[model samples]
Target chain A: MEKITSLADLKRIKEQVQSKIKLREQSASAEKLVQIRVGMATCGIASGAKETMSFLIEETEHQAIDAVITQTGCMGYCYAEPTVEVTLPGRQPVIFGHVNRERAREIIDRYIIKGELIDGMIPVNFKTIDE
Target chain B: MKTIADHILDIVQNSTRAGANLIEIIVVEDRKRNLYVVEIQDNGAGMSPEVLKQATNPFFTSRKTRKVGLGLSLLKQNAEQAGGGLQLFSAPGKGTTVQATFQFDHLDRPAPGDLAEVFLLAAIGHDKVRFCYRHTTGSGSFSIDTAELAETLGEVSLAVGEVRRAVAELIQNNLEAIGATR
Candidate 1:
């Protein structure tokens, strides 16, 4: 592709990105697509959330799964560094703790693809304002 | 938060959110001046003058999800605590540039942290946007542009597992070649 230099070109690309993200967002609220959020705080980074995130993003795409992966700040789960929250369509979001590349792949293959909930789940103990 | 790289990640997220397609991250270590400078320039929808005035205020935010924006404020505080400062230049409908400086050897200064991760995250998270990362340590310098990498890959997505691994290794190796260790 062409190198984005001018403001117009940048805006064009931004529109494309925004459209893709919009699809993901619409899917999240419409309960039509799987949504994944990887924690990327300082603690998460130190524990290798970057690798896990890359794995999920790539693996999901490679597997041809209709999932959107996004980054998030710390979830106050520092003890469970490298955490990931996965939300299947029409289901409650599940927070997975201590995720690595292997676990990321497993999440995609078993939990995400097959709807088989594996280990590394950090049980929700508190309620949110929306709740 | 704990490292300069973390601050960079936070600020760059702002750029991506601002609809930037090109984000440039420059790190310069000037031993002679005992200064470490990080500059993030983006061709995003810049802020209005009214918002620019309070971009560094912890109480200011443009997001509806929260009432306070602490990224720029925390970075400014970190730089100041290390005997340096942060500067933001932006214009409505133009773009934004954030320059943060820290004392090179200040005891309070945090390490640069994992920059390779930062680049990789930005690359994969914003696949459509292009990133240019340059690191300079008085000795030498190295720069990598995602657009150039994409040209080399020829239609391969950086989100691919092998490609992601290669990009991360390339960043690590290039930084090492230039003696930019964190």
Candidate 2:
């Protein structure tokens, strides 16, 4: 799939967000929950996102992490894909770059479980407008 | 090398790497003919002719981060080394098909890969994408269509624990039955 370039395109894409949110709501609950969002735009897939996502889900479930894994369309970070955004309950979200199975496990064990920051982070260079 | 199950997992992982949203994996073990065939089909943006020509070259990957793409090349080599052969067909917007056949008795033929886990992984990984996988041994066959399951389950996602377990168990039990015959 091609990139959704403009705000109009983003709006068109957001049209499906409601239904997707509904689907997600059926299971996802915030109880020390681990929320994993895989960057699933076409670029991510080309970069092996599917396999990475699968490995993460299997390993997380195998270890019985309180995780809810889901996919979101591009975040304009194609170069950083197959990217992953992890959010622990009551904590800020962190984005990780070039995620694979090995790194995924590390994230689960250290970051999710112990709240330690492992390497492989794509540094945040820009301060948010809100900040 | 691990079992054929591991190889299948690795290869199927490559299919997702190729941007395939729809993947169909078929495995057939024919005892009478003493042959085994595995086919992986995907509806993804396919390789261009130039890339297709060099797909087996190992050094000709389009990946910007990696120096080489070895997945398909390695799979092709493994198949050929085992007295079987590999065939790949692709078109730019159409999709790709990879088929490998092996003589069951060959020394290098790998053992059956962990297909059960493969389906489970796929069902969870690409819940939005559809995976239609079927396995047929000499005695019987097992098939799973995620699209069908999604339609049946209503708003519930396949990523849910119970659903993923059911799909995983279904593949495992069917595979166990097939293995029982031999």
Candidate 3:
């Protein structure tokens, strides 16, 4: 592959990748695909969020589950450093705390694939104004 | 915040958020000159002259989601506290480069923390974005480019556990080989 040297080249590649993602999204209902957000702030990274994120991504893909994994900054849960928020189709988003590689695998097998809630669920305590 | 690697990760996040598709992070340790440098360059939506002027001001921010943008300012503080300084260059359509240097053995300078983890996170989190990381010491240097890795991996995603582990190990091993690991 050619090295991306300039901003123009970078923008061109970004457009191509974005279009591919758009096509993928268009092919499937957004609500049907699982959405996962991993906390990756300084605190989260210090606590092994990167490892948790890698595990989640790999396990989900290995299981042939269609999902979108995104990295987000702190969710203000410093106590729970490696936090993960999972949003199933039409259900409310559920946040998990202290997620390690093992917890990640369990989340995938139970919560994600089987739609069964397991341990480590952090209850939604606050609400936005829209709520 | 606690280590140079932490600051690198924070600064790279700024680049990614600024619409950068390609980011380069370079760490050079010149023992003879007694300087340790961390430079991050990105082809992002570069800032305007006015914005660049205040880029290091903690109170100035372009994001509406937060009132204070302290990443750059804090990095500057960290560099200055360690007997070094920071320089930022940017143009509206060009790109941004942040270079920070510290005294090689400054007592206040924190070690580069968990760099392999930092590299792995950046590569896997922004799989579409190309990241090039270079670590140089007085003796030798090691560099990794994600684009090249992608070509080698064929269809495997870097987010895969095995891939991430391998990449991290590569980074750690190379850094150690060059006597740059902390």
Candidate that scores best on lDDT: 3
The reply for model 3, stretches above 4 Å from the true place, is A1-33, A41-68, A73-83, A89-131
True contacts kept of 3: 0.08
Chain A: TM-score in each model? 0.73, 0.70, 0.75
lDDT of 3 by residue, A46-76 (tens): 6877678767777887786778787776656
lDDT of 1 by residue, A11-44 (tens): 3444444434324433344466788888765456
> lDDT tens digits, residues B1-182, model 2?
23454455555555666677888988888868877888889888888888889988877766554455565676777788888888889889888888888888788887775576657655665566788888888778877677776655556556655455555555566667666222
Stretches of candidate 2 exceeding 4 Å from the true structure: A1-66, A70-106, A118-131, B179-182
Candidate 2 lDDT for residue B34: 74
CA lDDT scores, all candidates in order? 0.77, 0.68, 0.78
Candidate 1 residue-wise lDDT, B41-138, digit = tens: 99999999999999999888776644667778889999999999999999977899999999999988889988977887877667778899999997
lDDT of 2 at A73: 46
Tell me the lDDT of candidate 3. 0.78
Question: What TM-score number comes out for model 1?
Answer: 0.71
Question: TM-score for model 2?
Answer: 0.68
Which candidate, 1 or 2, would have the higher TM-score against the true structure? 1
